[model samples]
Target: MEVPKKEDVINEMREILGNNDYIVQVVNTDNEVVNLLDQESGELQLEATANIFIGGSILDRGITIKNILCFFYGRNPKNFQQDTVLQHARMYGARKKEDMAVTRFHTSSAIYHILSRMNELDNQLREWFLQGNDQSDLNAVFVGYDKNIKPCAMQKIKVSDALTLKKQQRVLPVGMWTGSKTATKKMMAEIDHLVNESMCGQKLDADGFFYMNKDVAQQIIALIEDTYVYDEKYGNIDHKSDMRELLCALEYCTERSGGKLRAMVRTDRNMTRIRANGGFIDSPEDGRTDLKPARERALHEPVLMLLRQNGQKEETEYGNIGWNNAPFYWPVLLTQEDLAPVMFALDQRRKGKQLTIDLTEMLEGVNPDEVLKLSYAGNPIDQFGKEGTTYANAEEAAVETRWLKESVASLFIEKDEQGNWKHNPAVPFDEKNDHGVYSLNHGHFPFVLRDYKYILLRNGRNANAPLMLLELFPKDEWIIDPRGDFDEENNLLDDNGQDILLYGSDVIYDKNMNKTNFEDKSITLWYIEYPVKRVVKYKCLKK
Candidate 1:
């Protein structure tokens, strides 16, 4: 493909502008660049005249355009670098109130959406810093992740613990209980009635599907919150805390998307308590990956999927995971893709030790679109040096199953044969290892694990290990680093699209409790699309 000549570019701009009243200058590397700096004084030089100047990376930084009343940005690169993209905000800075009021930004809808999310993230960071928020008080700094948008240029970043929430992500709660059978039955019936009365007209193509406004969605969330019970000890769930974060993210999205949300009332799922591959709940009836039809219909809004389980009382393979023998509704919140492909820099430090997210350095670049195609499940236990594997026999499986029912202490600490307290051999626990069990659930059981190795290295672990740092995904799947590949410098080797990412097995248990063909063979970084933008403290689960 031949590049268009400068004359052709000037002609096209002239035609688009509709008139040749202003001089069109192609201020590029080949052309005589417009004078932006005084030759001798080195001060800004330019006449207060009306002229149209077009440039590329040259205009990305260290160059200012005066009185940018109307900006027409149309650089359609396949991948966008966040730092370079933000630097193109030459239109920003102090301006006359009247001039600012009249200024307008023009870009494609795709570019506009990502830019809007980036602006929100930038503003959030600025607000926290300006308000004199202590570094210790900070949680995570969120950066909207998009397939087309790269957070920062590759090669520039070496190592980072940046947590990501990808676009079009779904988050569900699996490790939870729905009260007693009677209470669950009553709650389910009441919710069914509420949906029939309020969301009947908003039905989608599916039988139990409906689209709702923020008001109706809030009602449903509240009902689910009231009916659900979570035991932070064995089960890594806290309905109340999760609900709060959900409501917060919902409000943020509602303000932008006109308060639209989708819901599905799936009944009689009969899903097992412990699903394969870290799923809190099983797939939709069609088994087409978390009800793809309903998700596509919403386009750019949250989907509140309510699945009613069969409430089987019989013991599951992993034994009873504390769910009461009663039919209950399981709610899964699917945050929209409009504000995704993001990262959060959370200060998970407790009791003030001085740790901050340097937004400039923490940014990373990866083609998340490629990552989203693979269906990978994260095992939180993997971070503790335990590779996901299958049970050799039912007896071995039962031993691990019993651990799931044990206290939170059992996860990391255990009593030896002599009944002496010792660090669990499974976990490589050390004073230098800065890991915390974050109590925020995003699909995977045991909630999100905080691994701020960089932060904790300086001060070391506290008396009580304070949970910090987390990553959320947009889709139902998780991010995987299967090869266990790292650079010589010990940096995570960026994905080059060669590795095969396995999809959909939370923990590779021996199928049928017998060592079978399927045994987890690799380690992966688990991420779920989480919409909670700010860092909020959740009580440590005590068994």
Candidate 2:
């Protein structure tokens, strides 16, 4: 048989690819092998003495050729031939094909081992990576792969970068409930004690512990009822009358002394007991234990006597039991300036003016529009109702209409003068009240706005303005009239958008006092829309 020409071999290879529908096209027809229209299946198949290149025609197509075995079909030339011909002969062909197969096998095996080792190493390194690069040497030493397939120094550098990238993408810790050891121990002890007390007389083995502790049950019940009475009287106060008297006297003394007498007294007999029983003793060697009784006499006794006199007088005249006699006792008090802003805000509220502070603006520095979006639940109608909708342009009207349909109704209506229909005077109507003025069951806009402002201030924003409003609404006047206003069908009336008007109040002044510069001010105003009803407001008259 005549030797095939180089052109013939090329044409034959092209024909084979074309016949099998695997050929895309061919390129670089000079001396070097270059692929242009290459298609790959599971395996590669080539009938050539020359080197060939192969890949997918479309970059994304899967390789589908199978069994990819190659065999040289030409014989070696006996004499030196042209370099190109020698390179393409059977001897070079077989050697090149062998090398390709060996290289592929080794590369595959190496990759598999690397991946397996990588998983193991990753598991070991996971914690280290999470802790960050604070311990770099430990991370470097612990990272390992098979010695034969060990990554190069460059690969190590890349791996370190990869680790850092992974760490950066990790989630951070949210809120922390951290505390000192003493605090934690105290909390745990309290919880355990509560649980024990709760389960104290319960049955253990069948009618066992409960039946056995009958007297104990009676004692526990009595204790609970008695303690409940004390709790009611003092709230969180430790020594009912004693603490109250001491506190009151201390206040008087402090004011008289221009706050020079800043000392606090413990009037609770329990506190005296603790001090005597070494409960208040921080160390046995402190040497001040003998002075406990003296301190109590000098601090607590006088205060208690003064408070008793005041309480007796109050009881005689007004039949009012002082708050000091309440069950629980919490010794926290607010001074006039401490409550100033709230008083001012309350005054503003009484005069029928919008008193509000945007918390989002103060804390987050977010855009007003974004803040509005966060506060608003849905489209204009959805949040505000059809008539309540505020539109910036006509295009928004259709969208707003669609949004209103999906939204909850917030419209409230009230009869105005001349028997004409009018929107509820309150802005941000509550669904449960006919009148926009806040009652227990409805009128929540002021509360929500106030809370939002508080949160902003709590989060380190300027909350001074909102605090003023808080003073306007004293604790005593916090009454919610659940049954105040309802529709004819007895359904709760929605506040509509008029609930916003609830915040419109001028200045509320103290009923008895005419001093314009009082430390704390209490004022009442008529609801702007419902002028017949008086709303009490508190303010700090300082600033």
Error of 1 at 35 (Å): 32
Task: Please give the distance, in angstroms, between residue 33's alpha carbon in candidate 1 and its true position after superposition.
Answer: 32
Candidate 2: worst-modelled 10 consecutive residues by lDDT: 340-349
The true-versus-predicted C-alpha distance at residue 132 of model 1, in Å, is 17
Model 1, TM vs. native = 0.41
RMSD of candidates 1 onward, in order = 18.4, 30.7
Q: Candidate 2 residues 133-162, lDDT tens each?
A: 324321232233322222233332432321
Question: Model 2 segments beyond 4 Å from truth?
Answer: 1-51, 55-61, 68-174, 177-543
lDDT of 1 by residue, 101-212 (tens): 6577876665677788767767766775675542422233445454445678644443333445444555554456667877667767777787677666654654455777
Scored by TM-score, the top model is 1
lDDT against the true structure, each candidate: 0.48, 0.26
Error of 1 at 482 (Å): 6.3
